[model samples]
Every structure is written in C-alpha cells, then in structure tokens.
Target: MAEKAKVYFTDFRCPSWRENLPQKLARLMMTAGFGDIEMEGKYVAVKMHFGEPGNLAFLRHNWARVVVDLVKSQGGKPFLTDCNTLYVGGRKNALDHIESAYLNGFNPYATGCHILIGDGLKGTDEVEVPVEGGEYVTAAKIGRAIMDADVFVSLTHFKGHEQAGMGGCLKNIGMGCGSRAGKMEMHSAGKPYVKEKKCVGCHACAKICAHGAPVIENGKCAIDQNKCVGCGRCLGVCPKDAIEAANDEAPDILNKKIAEYTKAVVAGRPCFHVSLVQDISPNCDCHGENDAPIAPDIGMFASFDPVALDQACADAVAAQKPLPGSVLFDKDSGCDCGRDDLLYANHPDTDWKVCVEHGEKIGIGTRQYELVKI
Candidate 1:
C-alpha cells in the first residue's frame, strides 16, 4: 500500500479574539508544508478561476489576498491567472478576461498581485507539453504564461460540475491552465467547423493553419475534416468568431483527459494545492449564474498532493447533509438519493471519482489521504 498523503483542514468558525478564516487558512497551508518548497525569487503561477460575470458564488478576492501575501513572504513573485474560455463568454479573449476578472473584484488592489490571462490575447498563445504516461493525450497545449512559471500553485473552489463531476484542485489546474486550443482538444475529438452564416470570408483561418484545412468558396469557409489536424488555431484567429469546437467528448473521457492535462502542467515542478470547500455550488464558476450551494460550507484544505487534496475535500463534502432549498436537497426530499456522494446527488450524470482515480493511475498523487484538522 502507498503511504497516505497529508491534507490539512480548517473550519470557518472563528472567535472574536482568535484568528479569522483567512488567517486560519494561512496557518493550514503552512502546516501542510507550503513553506518547505523552494520559492526564493521564482515566478509562481497561482492558477484559479475568476468567476464569470454574474456568478456570485465564486471565491472572493479576500481569500486570494491571503495566498498572495503568503507567496510574497516566501520571496515568490505570484500572479493570479486563468486561461480564456473555449466557449463564447465574458472571458473569451484576454481583454475581456481581464475585464471580467476586474469586474469580479480580483484587481491588484484586492488580491495584492497582478493578473495575467494565461493564454495571450485571443487565447492563442500556447506551449505544446508532452504528457508522460498519458493514454488520452500525448501533448497538451498549455497556456504559455502558465508553462513559463517556475512554480505552480492551485487555489481551487470545490464545487459540483455538470461535465467533470466536481471542480476541485485538478479541475482548476488542468482545465484552467489549458489554452483555448487545449480546451478544444480535451472537450472534443472532432475538428472545428465554421458557421457559414457567421463567416465573413476572412481567410484568417487559412492563413493561420499550417495544414490546408480551411476551404473557402462563395464568401464562406468550411473545415476540411480530412486535412484538419485539430490544432484549434483557426478558432482563435477568426475575427468574426465563426469557428466553434464540437464539445462532443464523453464525460468519462473528458475526466481522463483532465487528469492527463494536469500531469503535463505539474510534472517536474514544485507545486502546492489549496481548495476551499465553501459555496458548494452545483455548477462551475464558468457559468454566468450560480445556483444555491448544494451543501453547507465545509472548510479550507491544503496539501502538496493535489489528488489527495481533492479526495479529502470530496470526502468532506460527502459527509455533509445537503443544504435545504438546493437542488440536491430537492432530489433527496423527492425520493431515495441512493448514494452519500453529494456531488453525484447534485449531478447524477457525473462521477467525481474518475478524475482522482486517473490522477492516481498517472502518478500524480494517491487518493488515499490522512486529513489533519488544524
């Protein structure tokens, strides 16, 4: 049997004379061996989701400030970062992504660090990284800025996800660090297609493609599937946003790909993960609107092993009763929920365990963990 990884936890309860939640979180991270990492004058990529516009359940900037301060104390140049979305949204481009992040109060004044959209403007900047021991993807197209970092740290908001089951440390680093093209590859096995009505005969796609995939005629563009390599470059350069990725990958494969992508990002790097199990929304922060929390606020968790950290957080959530007025509670009240897994109860179509199991299989970290309360 593999030795269990240690995951540190702390509750939200704070006495008037005692330290607050943020302070407690800092202590928890320290206890989890965050200070032991060699971070003297290194560029640390603090990967996290800047909630989509109108999503109120996303993590607040105050929590980020605590992380920023900790990184600074260790002489690490930390920056908050997330890649642009593959779908059309407020964060589809670098300019819009920064705007949305600022709109959500992740400004430098609040978080005490600069915000760098992982992918450059238009979500095209990327570095092809080879995923060792990967069965789904061999090379993952990760954001150039994220790949340039000397250290990687994930600050995740643990929540229910419609596709990947649960949004935890792996979700934050893997999917969040991928460039737009990377996201396309993970979400779809098919190549991108052009909306003839939306295409303005820009020929921009043709110009960007090394392969002659974009065929143009009659003021319209279409991807030639035979020639298309699915690099997803055309999707970024099209001025009219006419091209769209086919998000047809199954949930199980998507989860496995997420694990592989995470392996590519964290391999041969000093990494630490922190997840706050509060505002357990039933959907991702990528959603413009958030539903009520599925479970009550649990606490914060920190560990060197992201897989173990996620497993610990998920187990913590599984132990909680569903929050009243939430979708999970509604399902439980209606009939037998069958399982104690709150994430699955919230989104029955998804199984959060797949990602962690794959992560362990890929040598990222073990799912077995010893949760130490702080």
Candidate 2:
C-alpha cells in the first residue's frame, strides 16, 4: 500500500573496541542518509535531553561529539540544544540548564560543540511557529533558537516514559523542543495547583509567578486558574514540591499534541533523527534518578522519518528479553508472557502507539519502515 520509510540500524557489537560505539553511531547516521542534507554554513540544531543532574541514562557527551564532528565536517554550524523543562527541576532556566548539562558532562570539551538553551534564560524567549493541518495546536511556541536553525537533528535517548509510554524520537523532537509555555500547553488542560499538605507557607511560588496565581493565606497557597497562564514557572520554584500539574488531558490527546508539536519543529527544515535504544530505562531521563533498565540494551537507529525510527525501535525492543531484575520483569509476570508490548506492559495507563499513529495521520512520517541493519 504505502511506501515504507528506511530506518538504518546497528547493533552494540564493537568487534575490536577501536571503532567504538560513537564511530558506529556516526556510520549508522551516514547509512541512514544524514550526509544527503546540504549542511554547508547552515545553522543545525542537534536537539537532545541533557540528563537531569543525577540521572545516568542519558546519552554520553562522547556520543554527542561524534554527531557534532560529523556536522562540522559537512560545514554545518551545529549546536547542542534543548528547551527548559516544564516541571520543577534543575533545568528551568538557561543558567541552571547549562549547569545541569555541564554537571552531566555535556560541556564543549566533551561534546565538541557549545550548548544552547533554546528558550533563552527563564524559558521565556519563544517563536510561535504555525503547525499546518494541525488538529490541536495551531501555533507551537517553540524556542527562538530552535526555530532559527536551518536544519534540525534529534539525538534522542530512547527510553520508557511514565506518560508517553516510551520516549522515542517523536517525544524527543516534539516534547523536548517545546518551550516552557508550549510544554505547559501540551501537558495539561488546566492550570497547576498547590498541595496544602506540602505547602510550607513559603512565598516562593508567589515570588516566581508573574500573574500572582499563587495567593498565600494562612500559610497555604492556592493557584488561581483564571490568573495563571500555565507558564509552569511556579512548579519549578516551589521549594516544598507543593505545586504539581493538573495532568488533566487524556493520554491519547497528549500523544497527538506531541506529534503536532514535533511537526511544528521539523515542518520546513531538513530534519534527521537518531535514537540510541540503550540503557532501556523504565522512565524518562528527566527524572533525577533512573531505575534499572527494563530490557537489555538494543542498538542505535537512524532515519529521516522520526515516526519510522520510533517504530523500528519499538520492534527491536519487543524482540528482546526483559531484564530479570528490572521493573518490567517484576511487574505482573502473567501479562509479560506472549506480550510483545513491553512498554505498555510496563505502564498500562499509557498507550505509546497513539503518538506514532497521530504522527503518521498528521503526515509526520510513516510507521511502515524497512529496517536496514548496517
């Protein structure tokens, strides 16, 4: 029926250790058509998540150097980039974000490129890019620096997500590229609220909130939804971990929105996606800590179509045996039998397929892919 997209793959087998994993990744990307793009003197955004401070599941800085060196060889002006997080964490502002990246070893000396916090300091600098044929977001508030890039490349850490089920290429490009406001828009249908028990009467939330959404009374703060613009700044500034997102949106809708956001990021640009399906962690890299991997390490995958790349990765993970002591192995062994969908089996509340289906339906990419092992 439809033409299948080509997804290049490579196992983690390094015959002599001289070639190394980074070299293998570079070779895989080239095989997947990375060199086909005209990159001479063009601004290329290498989007990826710099693992949160203590998380060890993110792609190493050495892996990033390989991509950076490749882009430089092609005369592309490449920069490592990612927008601020929506949740309260170590990466809400550019300063803290860079610190976190450096803490996680994403420094220039390590990655062979400078890091650019896409949304600027305070995560307020953004460009509203129109999403063509979008059912959810008409205009996505993307980081100005990301939108300024002539080419977009996603270097994703393919792992499990509590919400998206699996954070693959689509999740990396879509949700990872969104600005603070954009992330807020995709995350929940309503504003955040303060938990009374967790609130310490600290005016920290009130101090950070521009709209005065957090009003303190009797040492307890309440968020006024009418006044709150859902910027998600308070969530990060709260010292007591009192503020939390409503998370009111349906999982399917959230997945579709992620696809729409991804379309916005890569729509008019030359885009390439690379996913390292290793570390097979049971949660997103955004977490401060990572649990043991759910499955054994798969390998690297690269594709022009993120949807195709993600599908190929999903298939690869499905073919693997779950790690005996990991979360998947311990979670209801009954369902694990004959269940190919380990991601869903790990988190039954979320359906990872929704994102890819919406991606295909929205012309992001095709799910049918030819997995070409390099």
Candidate 3:
C-alpha cells in the first residue's frame, strides 16, 4: 500500500483568490477523492476553537465559511462546535459559550452554519467511551454531539503549547473535545493542594467544591485531603492562587492520555483534519491574549489521518525561518550549526516529535505521508 500523503497549500500566492476559498477547498477535497454528496445531508460537525474572548489571533471565520460552504455544496449539513471549557470564565456554560461564539463572528449567517456547544450546559453532558488501554483503565468522556456526528473535521490553528509541546490536530481533537470533568480526569492524575501563603480564604473554592472538602478552619479555607477526590473543580474556581496541581513531570503519560482522549472523540467516525500555520501563538488560544507569532504565515494542510496531518504540519512549520519582530526575534539563542529553524527559533526546550510519535503508536495515524500541494 502507498503511504498516505498530506495535502498542503501555502497562505502565500493565494491572496487574490480569497473569494474563491470555498470552491478551492471543494476542488481540493475532490482531488482527495471526496464527493459533494458524501458531505451532503450528513451532520458535518466542524470542530474548531472559537478562541477565548480576549485572544486576538485565531482561525478566521472566512476559513470556516469556506469549509461550511464546501460541506454544503457536497450536500452536507455543517455545524460549528467546541466543548465547554474547564476554566471558570467565559464558555464554561452553554449560554456563555454560544455568546462567545457569536462574539467571535460565528453567527448563523456569517459562517453559513449554526454553532453548538459540544458538551451541554454546565459542561457535564457527556458519554463515556469504553477503551481497554491499560493506562486509560475504564473509559474517556467525549461530547455527545461530536460522538454522534456523521462526519468530523478538526480545523486547528497550529501553535506552540507550554504543556503539550505543540497544539496540532491531535491536541485540537483530544484536549479540545474533552468535557470539563473529562479534562479534570486528564489533569487529575496529580493531586491538587492549597498553598497556605496564597490562600486568602476567599471561599470561592469552597463554594464550587461539591463534597465540601474545603472548609473555613482557623480563618483559612483548607482542603481536607481525605475528602478531596482530586476532581479539580475547586482548583478552577479558586480566586486565590492557593489551589494548584501537584508536580507532574511525566509528559509521556500526559501525551498518552491526550491521545486516548482524542481516540474517544473520533472513534468510528469518518474524520479529516486541517492545520493552519499562522499566528502560531506560544500558549493555547485558551489564554485571553495571544503573543506575536513566531513565524510568518506558513500554509494550510489537510489529511484523512489526523496524526500524519499533524506531523506533516509540524515539519512544514519547523522548516521555515522565524520572522523578525515576532516572539522569536532573537536568532542566537542556541543554533550550534544546522538545526531545525522554526523549532530552534521559537522554543528551544520543546520537542514536538513526542505528540506525533505517541499519536502514531496509538494507531491515530502513520507519520509517513506524501506532501501533495494544492
């Protein structure tokens, strides 16, 4: 069998044809062997990060519009989706999540689609998918709307991530699709504790804690270790910086869990992936604001294999030279001789290979791919 090839089209030399984006993407899909009716009449869930309110650099609605139109032209009914956040601010509830999506220019007529919060109200509506992976033990929780979709497409804004090395297709689907409690499970392997110095007895944590494990004792709210289940609910709501996750130096474990969660989200679905290498923020778009991009707008990639798509996207981005006046303006950090320009320039400590390798090991997709340019 031939190796799967990832389709690539750069942001360069594509400005004049901006209005033809829908037809362009449709033609690309045709070349990839997808018919218009294949997407037509299907519940095409276009999974994407609408981005936090304060974050400026995110996937544009024009791109999503192109995708929605293509799905429609092919007879697919498309709807934009993202799960409720684990954080305490905006998008924690369905109403606020919808409002955030609207504020981000994803209104019904704008993107030629409707927006739905993947996990229902309060971030609790989810179905647990059973997987026999040794590390995952019981199962992983995924958003029901995503689970029920006839077809799925993860359109990710690829960028640097502090914890996962990079946020590509796998991170976009795994961590992106997880409900709040599911996210709690992924991050809960380590226990959370209260820092006495930062604990101001604000009682926010106490209010959100379901078990009442945190009680005001001696003028300070304290977490009863015995009663605490490490659910992480209190940690997210804690106004004071008292509650924090324990040291988790095991990145490999975290990567594996992310992969398993991604599996749960896309299990048995005809899924596709697209990663845009523009405005590559250092932290996730979950943050309120995005720092300058480390590189110029690179390109867009598409593939049937999420893992290979991500790996290919990373390789393409890492081959580019860093743009001056961006986050990685300095060139002499530590390039001994011939190093990967993008990786070495943007972040010297991170290794993106881990995400692709782990993803491949779990049968997410093969790293081998051909670069078919559109």
Candidate 4:
C-alpha cells in the first residue's frame, strides 16, 4: 500500500528538531490538509494525556503550546484534553484529573488553553455516539468534552505498554477517548483474583468495584468472584497493587477495544495524529512511576493514518541501536543497528504487532506505508 501517513522523527538530542518541532508540526498540519477544514470557528480538540503525576516522561508542554498557537492562528480554537481514567487513581475524577494535569505543568497559564477532563466531576459524564464496531453498537460512551469537539488531533507519547504491546495513535484515540465506563469495558474483558496475602484490603479496590466483588470484612476488601464483572477496575485502583489485569484475554480484548474506541473518536471529525518516538519507555505512562526507558529517544512522527504512522514509528525504533544505559541495551543486542526488535526479542512475552495488524484488518489505516523523512 502507498504511504498514507507521514511520520517525522525528532528528538531533544538534535536541537534542531527540538527547537523546530512546534513549527514543523504546525506546517505539517497545514501541509497534510488540516488547513482545508471546511468549518470556520471550529473547536479542534487536541487529545493528549497529561502523564499521571510522578511520571516524568510526558510530552513536553512546549510542543503543545506551539501546536495550540498554530491552531488558533488558523482560526481554530484548540483545547488540550483527556478523559478521566477508570481506575481510582490521580485521574479518576475531574478534580483529581485536573490537579494531576496542573501538577504535570498543563495549567492553562502554561499552554494558553484550558485543560478539560473529558468526563466531568464523577467520570460518569458521557455522550454516547453510534459506531459500526462489533463490541459496540448504539454508541461509545465518550467523554462529553471529546465528543463536543468539531475536529480531533491526537498528540501521543509512543512507548511500550504492559498490556497492548505499545501505545500509539490507536491507543491514544481508542482507550483515551473512553469515559470511565468505556474504560470499564476495555479492562473488564478479563478478571484476575487477588492474592490473599497481598491484600491489605484498605477498601480502595472495593469502593470502585461496580460489582460487589470486593467486600470490606473487618476493614478489608474481600472480592466475591460470583458478583465480580471482571471489569479489572479494582486492580488498578488498589494502591498496594494487589489487583492486576489477569493475563487471561486482557491483551487481545484490550486491543480490540482500543480499535473500536479509535473509530468512535474519529467517526466524523477530521482527525490528525502526531506520535513522539522519543523516550520509548518499556511501559505505558499510565504507571504512577515511570521506569527507565527501554529504547533511546527516537524522533517525532505526524500522520493522518494511524496505522501508517505507527508502522513508520515502529520501523524507525527498530532501526536504532539501544542506548547504553537504557533497558534495551542492557539485554543482549544482536539486531541490526537500523532494524528494531520487530519480533520483540528483548521482550519475548509481549507482541506490539497485533494492534497494527488488527487495525489494518479493521480499516483504521494501513500497515503498508512508505517512510518519508523530512
């Protein structure tokens, strides 16, 4: 297939890309036909995740400032936003979610825009929109903020994922758009029991359990498997890490959910994507604590096609030698300097390819692409 996405990789290592990323991204949008947006005075939602507090590997606000300014220059009102998380963490509610964004330097003062949590105060605020995916029918419960936007642009931090292999355009749009309940669906596909010894109870997990799986018996949350819906929501809400997304079918189900959500986000809106390949962490930034990066800082990529952008970004990452201090370099390195670990040699257990293939099959974009370096 011909290349449908154009991914430009830039990094802090090269001061030019860092200094010029904003301008580059701005022009990229126009060059890629964002300027042709038919509606005037349209609201352009810049979908971005403000990394959970304590996680330092988030996309820089400076980059966002440039993009937002450019959008305004083009007469598009741009706002940076993300939906509340299903887990009972820093971002479970709008208040906590906004606080986390502010803590992460996304305050309105910094980015010249508002940081609106997709779901409102309780995370139950949603606007269901119809889509043609199997798992979903009537509509996806999208954050009202995201559904209200006239157009969508995803600014993603590309990195390794503990569940879906890697987080990229599709993950950003799909999982990111989900309201707390939407998140419930994606995570609920599998259920893992809590180890009795690991359970400090604390009732944290029990509180978020939509089902009465966890009950506080003598000040400890005891999960009743029969009542549990397998939402996996309780697992992440537990501060002690007692609950976990079981290895059952969570991975595949999560991927499918991600694709369906992406389709929902861009159903009618003209959407564009930019995936930063730098600081390729071994796990998603969803972690309260970000581990050391697994891959060295690569570059930035922008594309209208989520699939091609992901494929190009993956190819670029595979082509580089692991950084000396990073986790990937610590593993035995036999792959070519210019070829990434496509088979995930370092991570024999995880496979990032499934999402790309599934996305292609579902028509998210094309895995077949021509890499264009600018």
Q: Give the top-scoring candidate (lDDT).
A: 1
Better of 2 and 4 by TM-score: 2
Residue 48, model 1: lDDT of 91
For residue 33, what is the lDDT in candidate 4?
59
lDDT of 2 by residue, 253-307 (tens): 9999999999999997799999999999989999999999988888899999999
TM-score for each candidate, following the candidate numbering: 0.96, 0.92, 0.85, 0.82
CA lDDT of each prediction against the hidden true structure: 0.91, 0.89, 0.75, 0.73
Count clashing residue pairs per candidate: 0, 1, 6, 14
For model 4, residues 251-320, the per-residue Cα lDDT tens digits are: 7766876777777788776888888887777777888888677667777677778888888887776656
- Please give, for residues 1-374, the per-residue lDDT of candidate 3 as tens digits: 64675665544344675546555665565565555236656899899999889998888787898778778878898899998776555677788888987898889889998987887776666888875452552688778888778998888999877777778888889888877667766655655677888788888888888887898877677778788876566755666557765645455666677888887777686887777888887678888889888766776777788888887878876776666666666554432425754654455565667767776777777888888887
Residue-wise C-alpha lDDT for candidate 1, range 1-374, written one tens digit per residue:
99999999889889866788888889989989999988899999999999999999999999899989999999999999999988778898999899999999999999999999998997888999999999999999999999999999999999999999899999998899999889998999998999888899989999999999999999899999999988778887787889999989999899999999999999998999999999999899999999999888989999999999999998888767788899877766422457767777777777889999999999999999998988
Instruction: Kindly indicate the candidate among 1 and 2 with the higher lDDT.
Output: 1
Candidate 1 ranges with C-alpha deviation above 4 Å: 333-337
- Best-to-worst order by lDDT is 1, 2, 3, 4
Candidate 3 wrong stretches, greater than 4 Å? 8-11, 15-19, 34-37, 132-138, 192-212, 216-220, 230-249, 334-341
Model 4 spans > 4 angstroms off: 1-19, 135-139, 190-248, 333-343
Report lDDT (Cα) of residue 67, candidate 2: 91
